[model samples]
Target: MRAIFAALLGLTTGMAMAEMKTEKVEYRDGDTVLEGYYAYDDAAYKGEKRPAILIVHDWNGLDGYEERRARELAALGYAAFAVDIYGKGVRPTNNAESGAQAGKYRADIDLFRSRLNAGLEALKARPGVDPARIGAIGYCFGGGGVLELLRSGAAVKAAVTFHGSLATPRPADAANIKAKILIQHASQDPSVPLTQLGDFIKEMGDAKVDYRMIMYNLAVHPFTVPGPQYNEVADKRSWAAMKEFFLENL
Candidate 1:
């Protein structure tokens, strides 16, 4: 009888894992084929409409890390999808290549916004998602992308950025922002220094936008990812802040 009970438990656990599902989604941005990852908890979303979040990936493009983040959002009863910034099979194996690919879009704001829109449209079309309660979150380069999404007056309810660059060529464009913005950053990050953050804050202030910036002391670039620079204290607190913000807004 004990052995039979153990078998039953194993079967139940396997079924549960299967219910928490993920799939690779093939999409497009004007002729460029994009590959993305979509994840959701089948059991939680059954017969119910839930909020959907569009996740933008780091400079490395849409990889395992982004999918894991999507799955985490799914566990919170969100239909999460990670969008591909680069074209299908265009992943960069090294920093030099990644920078070049991400730079092209960053240089041309129109192109970048369109690419993000393509993904947002795809996620919003999902049947299980509540189209009216849509939001977005980004990491690294992706974080910067979502800010641009808000600046372009996208139909997002909320937008969150994690350690993303706050710089843009046209600061006045913040006037067009429609979504509530939250920026979580590492204070000591070399790429996004205090001066840049200050200017971003001033832009939002001048535009009378609803936004907030939270900085973590002693935390540097890429603190949330699994690496030597990861700060457990900062990560835990920042993640809690994001969860709380989304719960209230989305």
Candidate 2:
């Protein structure tokens, strides 16, 4: 009987896993072929459109991490798209390559913005997505990506960044931005120094932007990911904060 019960449990889990649907989506951005993965709850969204969330990847570009995040959002009843910032199926495995790719885009901010806009358009065009209600979340390099989107006056309702840099080479006009912003920062993050954070907060205050900056006292860079750099407590708290922010704004 115990063995039979175990077999039943395994079967149930497998069925649950199978119910999570994922698909590869490709769209044209000018002359470039952009690619990404779309995920959602197949059972819940069968007949109705759902709120959509765009997942922007780090400097590594589109990879397993962002795809998994999309799945998590889908389980929460959202149509989530893991956006591609580095063209179709391109992922950098090492710091050297990642830096090179990131630097190339950073050197020409307009081109970078165009790529992100393309991803947003793709998400908006999806059949089951509520184009008017959209949110975006990004990590590391992608974290900065979402900020750029918000700065560009995209139609996003909410934007969240995890361990993203706060400095923008071209400062945004606060009046142009319409989205409610949530920035999750690691207090001990070496890359984004405390002084820079202070300046960012001051700039936001001066601009009169509606924003919230949460600093995890003990967290370091990449605190949310469950990899080597993850901080379990900070991750939980930040996710809870994200959920609340999305609920209120998105």
Candidate 3:
């Protein structure tokens, strides 16, 4: 996914880049101002409709990591949008703060879905975007947020969760899910217990939702990021799986 894009969405008011445009955008969910980053190769898909991706950031909220992924997607010929779940200027500086802000959304599933759905709206509104061929990917806290989006039936073609929380207050809401789901888990991760994963599997089965779950050996929480347990192999394989899944479905 890391190839140079020919054109980006353009950075703030258009940079006139001949290749790859990255831009910061301001959107809203209720009165909360949300800032997001988006990237696309307008020229790559010129006059041709293409799929789009919506990203929910990790617990720390919108940051460079998510935007970097957007560029990667743009390189692969997809419009990618990194949504702000914690609102503009609300990025968490530490794990404690990250947990607190993410907890707020977790505690209120409706709010979490509302904010994430707003991000989806932003993605769908982009020029040349195919509203029917949209997908979402999230990491950590954002991982759970994407599940919330599916539970709320946001109409995405697919959803991916990387080391995301499996417990949900409304497991029965899985009945409303329409998108295919992929869950990437770390085998040795301490944060998300096997028990939660089991319940999630049962929930998805009970709802008859299309889904796939993968557990990587010797990996742990935040395995895809810069962390003690980061497994390059696992990260690459998981991303490949996601890309393939989206290709088949979207």
Candidate 4:
């Protein structure tokens, strides 16, 4: 009986894993070939459309971290796509490379938005995705990308950023945002000063935008990232907040 029970448990676990589908998707931004990670629950996608979420990667590009997040979202019954901003095979292996690659896009918001929109288009075109109920989330550099996507007047219903930049070259463009926004930040983050948060709040307010900002005290930069800087309490709280935000808006 013990052996039989163990066999049944293994089968169940295997079946559960089989229900979730994940793949590497090759896409494009103009002539640039971008590879993104797509994941969804096959059992939930049986000829039915579901809300989708676009995930923007950090400066390191499309790596395991983003893929894990995509799978987590897929488990939550939403189709998740982790986009590539550095083009195919352009992942940065070190801080210097990451800074340069991320900085290049930061210096040119137009180029950044264009790449982001291309990812959005790819997400919309995926099977079993409801284009109208789409949302976006970003981390670090990707968090800034999500904000840019919202500012670009994309049809996304919601946007969420974790430790992303609040400064934009065109603050006046906030008037173009059509989605509700959520900003999750580390209060002690030296990279993003409190003044920047104040300015961002003013920008959103001036545009009469619907948005909310949450600050996690004692947390430094990349609090959500799993490492020495990771704050367990803040990470859990921020993720829960994001889940609620997407549920309410998307």
Which stretch of 10 consecutive residues in model 1 shows the poorest summed lDDT? Answer: 14-23
Model 1 spans > 4 angstroms off: 1-18
As a TM-score, model 3 comes out at 0.91
Clashing pairs in 3: 6-19, 6-20, 7-20, 7-21, 8-20, 8-21, 9-21, 10-21
For model 3, the run of ten residues with the poorest summed lDDT: 1-10
- Model 4, range 1-250, lDDT digits (tens) per residue? 9999999999898677658889999999999999999999987757889999999999989999999999999998899999999999999999999999999999999999999999999999998899999999999999989999999999999989999888899999999999999999998898888788888989999999999999999999999999999999999999999999999998
Q: What is the lDDT of residue 24 in candidate 2?
A: 91
For candidate 1, give the lDDT of residue 62.
Answer: 87
- Residues 188-208 of candidate 1 have per-residue lDDT tens digits of 999897789889989999999
Against the hidden reference, what TM-scores do the models get? 0.92, 0.90, 0.91, 0.93
lDDT per residue (tens digit) for residues 130-233 in model 2? 88889999999889888888777789999899999777777755556788899999989998987878878877887788998888998999998778889999
Judging by lDDT against the true structure, name the best candidate.
4
Model 3: how far is 193 from its true place, Å? 0.8
Clashes of 1: 0
RMSD of each: 3.6, 4.1, 5.8, 3.4
